[model samples]
Target: MAEERTESKTTILIVDDSEINRDVLKEIFKDDYTILEADNGKAAIDMVVKSRAFLAAILLDINMPEMDGFAVLTEIGKVKLLDKIPVIMITSDTSAETERRCYEQGVADVICKPFEPLIVKQKVSRSIELILSKRHLEEQITSQTKLLRAQYQQLQKQQEILKKNNALIVEKICTIVEFRNLESGYHLRRIHDFVSILGRYIMNMYPEYGLTQYQVDVMADASAMHDIGKITVPDTILLKPGRLTRDEFEVMKSHTTRGCDIIRMLSDIQDKDYFEYSYDICRHHHEKYDGNGYPDGLKGEDISIAAQLTGLADVYDALISERVYKAAYSMDKAFGMIVNGECGVFNPKLINCFRQAKLEMNNAFLKTKMKEKEELKALHGEDDDYDDD
Candidate 1:
């Protein structure tokens, strides 16, 4: 009963030219609603415009003086109040055309006169119930939409943090390898650039490879880990200035598999795609296309594309850079050696991409070399002006 009285605070507007008809409706709804009265359509429109937010329903009469109910409905619609407040036509006109007009004007229902008070009350009550229910559902949907957007934003932030952590781990590992190999820090940078140049050329020139720019970038970054296993090799074998004996060479070859082991231990911390690319490049970068290289002689396309791309880049960098056992070959000689298969058999498709990327790769290496020289000069306190050549 208390709840019922609380709900009765809702307003109902009664519009009719006849005082008796308005009185009848006011009596029927008086117990359950706060009623407002207007004896004509113009007066009703003025009240509705002022009190639309407080109204639950409107009872309107069709045959009225000065203005008809239809004109009032049109005015109410222009202000967009019909949807928010239910309106039921209360009229003596029982003609089908009059009823149709009331409906077309967006009245909730038509109650014919002399009307049954119970039926009029029931129809108006149902319309108000439906409108209230719809509003409640709209509110719920809006709240849920906001929650989902917030959750998606949180997920994106977490993913970015994970990516940064993974990059930091890679950097630390590369730094360790640089110090152990007695190679300049720029060696890793050159390898990264070489892999990128070849990978992008392959992606653009051969649609069959199905490589996206994102995948190519991942492959280039993973190339840094290709020789990470060399960290496990003994300094006697790794830093030897003469040719390796057969037994020492076998131990050196083990670095490929050992590098994969190191990457596997980090699986928990690495992104799935990055881990897979790193593992493949570490384990199979030495495998030749003709199945004649070590440690696992994976042949042809059996080798992962990431490994193949990194393998080519690694060999190119190794040939052009001085190592413990050999002098650095000139760029022209190194390019010829790979094309002629003097080093090992390589994929014809990759060789073609290599040829296409040669100029860009050369430029990238020289750029890195110049940068390293400038840094060394700066460290030695040399003047800024230096020869471009």
Candidate 2:
């Protein structure tokens, strides 16, 4: 059974012009591998081309009839078969020149004419082992590459789904503040737009601030949550038609610190940079640049740029929009109040950004108002258009 199995194994093609040399090589490998014989180089090439897939190696004589070993090497090199199957040269001339020429023709090993059976067997075994190992490694690399590609595609799909869910959560939170009636329906929307306008201007004019377009967008999104803590304030003070007493005003001011607390509770669900932006804007948007504002009297650049931008936007929106305690001011009056330090002292740099962004901020406010009117008309059949007071 063992002999039968070896006879059915992959072939070793032995090519030589002498019958005696071909018979010698065949006797050596006859037990371990199936042996195929060719008396001339042309016959060897034909056998190799027909049975290349099943051939393990080719042992060729340098001096042969019709087509020499060099000619056979040249023909096989065209097909790139040498990369997969090694060719060992057998020669009577063992000079340094002949050996160099044999290796240059892509020969794996050179052997003298009076062949040593042990060395021949060992060299053939080693060459076949090396080829098999290389083939296995190539197959593994191809398989791993395909698997990594599939995993990368799967990760991208997961990230997209996560992004949509986060947007929905933000909308729902903003809806809660709207339901409480602390601000007008368009108040948060206006703030988001104003912050975006100012943020872009500041980023362009002051490269030292290290603000990117992405950070600007994050600050704009976070501005909506600046007043989220007002939900904790009582409706009596929040909706009071008259100015609050000193004690009630203090309670109203606590909304900033309280808003930060609320955001901390939600830290686990928010992205790292977004959570930081939200937390800073919420707690410090009410802070004054002159160390006189509420909660934490943070002054100047000590107040984060995100907080500063949101604070300016919040004051502008409050001035132009009708609230329970105050009627809406004109656009010109709102811009003047902020820049002149009437609402509260602000950073000089930010005031410059605010001044430069005046026309854009006005347009944004009007655009939002128009959109709100259109939405109201769609929902309640009200077609009355309102102007900036």
Candidate 3:
């Protein structure tokens, strides 16, 4: 009984100027539908706009006073309710042109006046079904689009988490290598900053290096792994106070290849650019531009620019910093050695960039030198009278 009452209360609108015509249609539908009536086209348009949520269909009279059925349809078009509400033209005028005009104005069907109640009921029922189905599909598409956007955002967060974890692992590897070399840990920091500074300068002066700012930053972090092979050398050779014996030097050189092998052991080390940069730097930082270096002896442009950058950074730090066997060279002397090719052959363009940046590099290193002195003093249990570089 409740379901039947709900079906009977479904709304339908009847529009006509003549009282008798409106009454006749209302009589036909009042039993099955709740009928709302408007005496003129203007009033019908207002009713449709106000009650469109519950209004199922419109039965419109073509010939009316003031605003006519066509004018009412133009109003419906303005509200964009043509797809959501079905409109059926009900009129006495049966001329073909009159029917054609109704159809042109987006009427769903045109029925001559004195139309059978059965035909009117069936047409309105079918139109409402089609409009409801379309609205349901549109709702489903909107829901799915929102879900897809949420999933894409979640995926981006996961990728960011993975990148941060990779960076942490890179730092761990750098610390392990520094501990093995008995380095003050400042070596890693200086090399990272030096490589980053030089990389940015090179990118600007030589775009052919094909480096983005992001790549330069990543290379700076990866540079810490360049000397990772030193971990494999015997402590006696690594900490030797004098020049290595020829045989000891040969064994020490193997650190380059051994570092690369260590990196290869990480199963999760995919062929990403940072990992590739670390591998090349670990194996080839010793290679000279003239092909006179150890291990694979990569020469000229054959060497990756990443390896070349780390090599120069490593050598510059080595020359200007004190080692157990040698006093720190003065800044002027260190500069002279590189320019004179006393350190090893390098890419000429890189050398030119160094020339331009040498003053700034020296100033930056002065700060690092002071910090290193403090650390060294603490390690040696010495007084502040330690000589400044």
Highest TM-score among the candidates is held by which one? 1
lDDT of 2 by residue, 172-194 (tens): 77788878983544788898899
Once fitted onto the true fold, the runs of candidate 1 whose alpha carbons sit more than 4 angstroms away are 1-138, 197-217, 289-293, 299-302, 329-357, 378-389
In order, what lDDT does every prediction score? Answer: 0.87, 0.86, 0.83
Model 3 quality (TM-score): 0.62
Number of clashes found in candidate 1: 0
* Candidates sorted on TM-score, descending: 1, 3, 2
- Model 2, residue 284: distance off in Å is 4.6
Q: How does model 2 fare in lDDT?
A: 0.86
Query: Candidate 2 has which clashing residue pairs, if any?
Result: none
- Local accuracy of candidate 1 as per-residue lDDT tens digits, 1-389: 95455345988899999988988888999888988899998999989987787789999888898899888899999998888888999888889999998888888888988869899889999999988988888889999999999999998898778678767877888789868863635687788899889989999999899999989988888888888898999999989999999999999999999999999999999888889999989999999999997887789999988898888888888899888789999999999999999989999999999999999999998898888777667755666566433
- What RMSD does model 2 have? 6.2
RMSD to true structure for each model, in Å: 5.6, 6.2, 7.2
What's the count of clashing pairs in each model shown?
0, 0, 0
Cα TM-score per model: 0.68, 0.62, 0.62
